[model samples]
Target: MCPRSFTSTSELLSPEPALVEPNAGNSHSLRANRLLQHAIPPPMLPVVDLDPEQVRVLGCLVEKQLTTPQQYPLTLNALVSACNQSSNRDPVVSFSEEAVERAVTGAKARGLARFVHPSHGRSALRYRHELAEVLGLDERQLALLGVLMLRGPQTPGELRSRTERMARLDGLGEVEAELSALAGREEPLVRRLPRSPGQKEDRYAHCLGSAIRHVEDSAPDEVRQRDVPSQSPVPAPSSPAPGAWSEELAELRHEVARLRRDLDELRSQLGA
Candidate 1:
């Protein structure tokens, strides 16, 4: 048995190691690279929500624009005129000069508006509402609503006549159509009035209280504020600066001087 051993060259050599090519799919290194690419989430879109008082103030501003397109976007004086003309009787949501100032300040703080002081003149001061569209009204509709709200109730014909005095409308038919559309929307802000005999026209009332309620219900809790004091009187302006004339007097004097200068220039031109 010891004599049977035989050595062969091929048999004695060690076999070559099996080839291990790198995996083409499902590799740990590839997965780690993909994970790194998706590490952070995207940012969200911005949301802007306004409080009820802010909403009311914006509505008033839009109404002013509607009534006096020539004077819009309204200056403080134009705003005062628009507010006064809106109602002869006292207003339920009357905005005093101080109130307007406060509201404008608050709105600016919220990044919703910008306004300059009256000392700079109307042109120097301007106010804008970023969420005007959220109130669901155009300037014309707002003005119409303000007028109707102030005067209680009015026929479409009456609205057309009154609005036409301040604003240019295509015709009574257009006014009627707008009123009908508003009524059809089932909006809590508008209430229809019964037609009377001998008057073929339909009447409408502005349901401001209902509108307020609707907004309150829809708004979030944080934006709601305590009710304004019911009997707060608008503060009177303090006496003018010492040795300074009233604004009206100063304006009149300037006008007279301008007229005199104009007259002198005309006379010189005519060689008189």
Candidate 2:
């Protein structure tokens, strides 16, 4: 036998909406609603769900903004460092070079960054993600945008140097070429900045948009602090210890060696 139970319709029904008097002074509920209205949710990139590393990469970018909002639009290297430095030091959270590159490429493909060529002709690149809407940009172009955003404006040569340190390229010619391409585009991705004193070089800036405002509002105070202009690209990944290439190369070599051994054994067995 089961015991009888009583139920109330009032319990099942939705609760009544809170009544607001004519002039409620700074109510908690009202402030919460205001915050919700202004809050910008994180990007919904596909890679976030499929690739954990990619998610970490995105987290790194967010962390950089939180740490240095003013210094916003972190260079790629800076983003990588932030991820490595995060308090969550689980093995799953580490940022490998392949992971970083794959994440960045995936993000860029999804229109998350504006890349610029390396400043000094290195393969390294710079990028800016000020706008929430990701925009496809190669390394060179991203660097160019970063330089312009931080420094206000500069000529091609100056931008070339700014992006080159990380670009890992050999010359400024590539930067020049990219600038030319941007200029020729029907709807240019970047626009030339107004000339400045003794500024012989041409400068450029990202197009202003509502997205920028959203990012600015959402970003933390520290990020806003370090975001100022500087003489050069900031130093490489300080925390992660910039030797990802060697580790990856070693892994590849080990795989190759294993494959060779397997092939040799298979050949001997066939002969037998």
Candidate 3:
């Protein structure tokens, strides 16, 4: 939820009751928290579908936790800044603290994130993602999801280089195998996109959410709005270049063909 930030270190010693602490000692709270932290049992792990902003918010938490542990439990200001950071982000954003907070609230509900009180004596609220436990992801999967959350979609080669520290994903084949596992899960964690015209490899994206947008160079006046995170209405689709209709069309055709093949396989299995 929208966690609080403290201005004085003195407040840490005698803090008010935490409205949303995940690790309360009480058995009931602990049990409830456990349920939320882990996916509902087998045969029904609900797909962690989320909005674009929630995706970004979760991604930011994971990234900061690994890359900037010193600043792991981010303050509201820091969280906002991380979410809006230009580097390693797709469809860059200018989200407000309120917007980020809203996304945090939504993320918490989905059991993919958590809000925390001050850490190491600081008297401020902080947030983190519980994706590793909830999704049963290894370090490799966590790294892959983090990159996709921050950067939208990317090829296996790109992921291999970016996920160096989070996991041992140095080879393209290694990355692809991991992606295939994620995509093949009963509740698929990721999905593969059709190849773009100029791109040699298909980009993979987290099915949880996306900030895709359609841009037109010839028609500057046409401002189309796509869906964003729960907090902010403005989406993060990196504005595509003009005259890319051909690419879009080709992608659609490829997708249709792929679906057809899958359908044929299903039919064969059914023996109809």
Candidate 4:
């Protein structure tokens, strides 16, 4: 298959210009896109089922690209630091370069990321995420996904707070609007998790793959301290509602789909 074209990393690193509406001349491109869409079958679309490590790696790439543009295409060491950074990340992890490299390779295979060589006198290869382009996400959508990937499930308010560095989410409404857009995609990328007992808001999580268990535990300590005001401790419920398990079942189905894809790829490789 031909490589998918998207905004180049260099272009992303450049200053943004004024937004303009598409002109009539671009109609040919739109027609081509529609024709290509019909030409490709649903099964031919790449399945996005990133493991937790891959999620963190891709999240770091997206976050760094927007937040630290001067160092957008991160080197291996830099990406490692971003992924393991004590701040911002929930359930802080210490991933080795090898682990990160493997995740990067997985993401590349999924067309969510790519490797690049740094310009100038530098020689080390760098990496950047193509998620925004591949997923057709705007800045707000990318910000929410990045935060969800890094921090795990969160309330809309929490997302708005954390994504401030990456996008301007004026209020919970804007966040919800964008979240709705993401969830409404043909292949949804996000889902709203069931509200826990005593919680006033529903937490949202990315549906790229299996859930990250550590993040499912609770909000980050810093987030709790900063955003969640202290309140009386609420007792844990004995059991969840019967229907609450439906979402979890769906998540398992996603994992199964990913496993099936992997098995198929292996069979193809072995020519079985």
Best candidate (score: lDDT)? 4
- In Å, residue 226's CA in model 2 sits off its true spot by 30
Residues 1-272, candidate 2, lDDT per residue (tens digit)? Answer: 11111122222132423444434676776777656645634322121121445445544454344445665555666766755763432233457666677776765554444465666545667655422333334555555654444343357776666655435435667777877775555445455654443556655544422232122333345444456545686788656445887888889999999999999999999995
For candidate 2, report its TM-score. Answer: 0.30
**Top TM-score model:** 4
User: How does residue 81 of candidate 4 score in lDDT?
Assistant: 95
> What would the per-residue lDDT of candidate 3 be over residues 80-155, giving only the tens digit for each residue?
9999989888879999989899999887766667889875688889898877766777879889989988887789
Could you tell which candidate, 1 or 2, scores higher by TM-score? 1
Question: What is the per-residue lDDT of model 1 for residues 177-258, given as tens digits with 9 covering 90 to 100?
Answer: 6676555544334557655445687667655444433422322332233233357788999987855667778889999999
Residue 163 of model 2, lDDT score: 58
RMSD in Å for all candidates = 35.2, 31.1, 24.7, 29.0
Sort all candidates by lDDT, best to worst.
4, 3, 1, 2
TM-score versus the correct structure, for each prediction: 0.41, 0.30, 0.62, 0.63
lDDT of 4 by residue, 1-272 (tens): 33233233333334423334446789866777667656743332234767989999999998998898998799999999999999989869999999999999888866688899767977899999988766777889999999999988899999999998898989999999999998876667888776655679998888878554333444455455666677998998878677878888989999999999999999999999
Off by over 4 Å in 1: 1-60, 85-95, 102-124, 128-132, 136-143, 165-171, 186-188, 194-201, 211-272
Clash counts per candidate, in order, are 0, 48, 2, 0
- List the candidate 3 regions with Cα displacement exceeding 4 Å: 1-43, 210-272
User: Who is ahead in TM-score, 3 or 4?
Assistant: 4
Write the number of the candidate with greater TM-score, choosing between 1 and 4: 4
Per-residue lDDT, model 3, residue 236, is 75
Give the clash count for model 1: 0
